[model samples]
Target: MTPSVPSSSRRARRRTAAVGVLVAAAVTAAFALTLDDSAHRDDTPDPSAVVTGSAAPPPADDSLLALARRDPSDALAVGRADAPVVMIEYSDFQCPFCRQFAQNTEPELLRSYVDRGVLRIEWRNFPVFGEESEQAALAGWAAGQQGRFWEFHDVAYGEPRERNAGEFSEEKLTGMAREAGITDIGRFQADMASDKARSAVREDQEEGFRLGVTSTPAFLINGRPVLGAQPVATFTEAVETAAKAAKAAGR
Candidate 1:
């Protein structure tokens, strides 16, 4: 039998893994902090390149990847083909706060908008860490190709450090798709590896940069940008504002 790592050692490993993601996610987030912290990177030139290895996602150093690697369900959906409003998320897997939002916050939004038919949700991958983050996003996208984007996205952030762990691995994503009820895994895998899917992920990141989204959980509602893990009220207000604007435009 394998001995469990000491709690302290395990925590140390998680914190160490989290460090690289913090730097990458913080690259855009520093602006929201004090002036000293605000000295971080902003306005990236090309987001797709970053997510695709120009910068690469971070390595598996934390538990978020482990959490993300678990088999995900096929309960979530991306984009609002039927929604009057669109909500886009700029996210990184290793960010603990994103995980919290996924667990505590997103559920409410789903009950209200995602299910209520008021809005559409779009998952935009912004892997800032290095290879691990990118790997995780790719896995989730693969799940999306299998028509399980939300299930994969939901479970991913729940992971404390499974950025590129077992289930989240490229090869393992197919199994996750099957678990998520996907019947055509081969087709899904092919789609995920296609340039169109890659372009979709990249376009999202590029648009996020254009909209000043430098952090995980930033939202673009009906074409407007809202940054950070804002409160539910903030999201409500933004949605209402966008809705009202769209209504006035007769859209």
Candidate 2:
């Protein structure tokens, strides 16, 4: 006859098993949720794929939704913190597709959803390009320290520039900060170089890596993974569907 396991030991083992299950699910979801390799490499590809989360309601304990911070004071976020739908954007500062989404689809979403308090948009700095990308991410966060993140974001994504070029040089970033209305240039520069800023950017980047994101402009809308710079209509439909689901479920 075998000895019975202690209750505490059994609970710990059960918890470990649960964590393992979630980890496996997240890894599988990441692969199933990413964009095509071609899209990541090019400026064009219609790059939209509605995966498992789109067609059906997400699980109540959606691991993807867990990624949403929903912090009201978050400078990189817009819309109501408790909005029925949340869109967590993972993007790189240097990616053309990211610029495409920012320039084209994002404005419309802001008008139709964010401004209307139906959706919340949280930004994740998932810089995958290289050193310049990292620097830009740090700059964006520094600007946010003074309530100028969106301003900086708009300026950075306003026009296309060659990747890894001098476009994101320190001097240029400082000029951009001034343009974005960050009053204290000294503080902004200091913040950009701070360990806090590096840690913040690193945290966002690691989150993206954990999700197996291999490209820019990825998103999780209400826990439904919508990869790449999808069309405005795709985002619109996703938001509307999520809002309706949230209401029906009394969320």
Candidate 3:
């Protein structure tokens, strides 16, 4: 004996199933949006950011490697123009991780690789911390006008300060320029306020955005992306690996 189910009961079950499916879809969509936002948010500091060890393969992007300007007279670059390895750094002066890298890892790279002409390091201003960050970057460029960019960089990242706490005021930047031995404070100020400085900073920021760099202290070692303030060894390894690869490619 077969008993037929009521049409109303069948319709009710179908409606409930449809609602469940819609809820599941909504939940999935929301989760995906969250992941997207977290990955691209510029202001959020990622705590888990660290040097990706040898286990993680380096990302490949020949275009990203081509971002190096390699100008011989470029004040923001150090090392040989045709070095086998070029490390392009996207950094913010006010970023804590950037400061960490500047204070800790960069000097080692300079001593071990840059001074030996095994690597070239290019600095790009990707200020995402706000007005003070932009001002500091401009100040750095201004110092570069007098061949004192690295000096200013050392002074700015010499100590840790509260982010955007007026540490980079116009007067402070002027003081830093003087500390970097700009010799001509007037010219430094003029350069800092010039349209050229702003344009230069904007270009760097745009390049970082284009490359999907939403965090400070991001780097491209021969086009391999290295995020966060990685340890000195991590940088050295990347540079060495890239140099080897470049040699093999006859680049």
Best by lDDT: 2
Off by over 4 Å in 2: 5-28, 31-39, 43-61
Give TM-scores for every candidate, taking all chains together and pairing residue i with residue i. 0.61, 0.86, 0.78
Question: Tens digits of per-residue lDDT for model 1 on 9-51?
Answer: 8999988878856644543443233221121222221211111
Q: Residue-wise lDDT of candidate 2 within 15-112, one digit each (tens)?
A: 98898688647654653553556556653334343222223323333455667899999999989999989998988888888888888899999999
Q: Candidate 2 — number of clashing residue pairs?
A: 0
Candidate of highest TM-score: 2
Clash totals, every prediction: 21, 0, 0
Candidate 3: residue 250 Cα off by (Å): 1.6
The whole-model lDDT of each prediction reads 0.57, 0.82, 0.79
> Sort by TM-score, best first: what order?
2, 3, 1
Query: TM-score of the candidate numbered 3?
Result: 0.78
Looking at model 1, report the run of 10 residues with the lowest lDDT sum.
45-54
Error of 1 at 4 (Å): 80
Quote the lDDT for 51 in model 1.
13
Residues 1-251 of candidate 3 have per-residue lDDT tens digits of 89977799899999978975664443233222212333233334453344332245344445445677888898999999998889999898888778778877899999999999889999999998789999999999999999999999999988766777788999988988888888999999999999999999999998777666666767878877776767777888888888888888898
Q: Please give the TM-score that candidate 2 achieves against the real structure.
A: 0.86
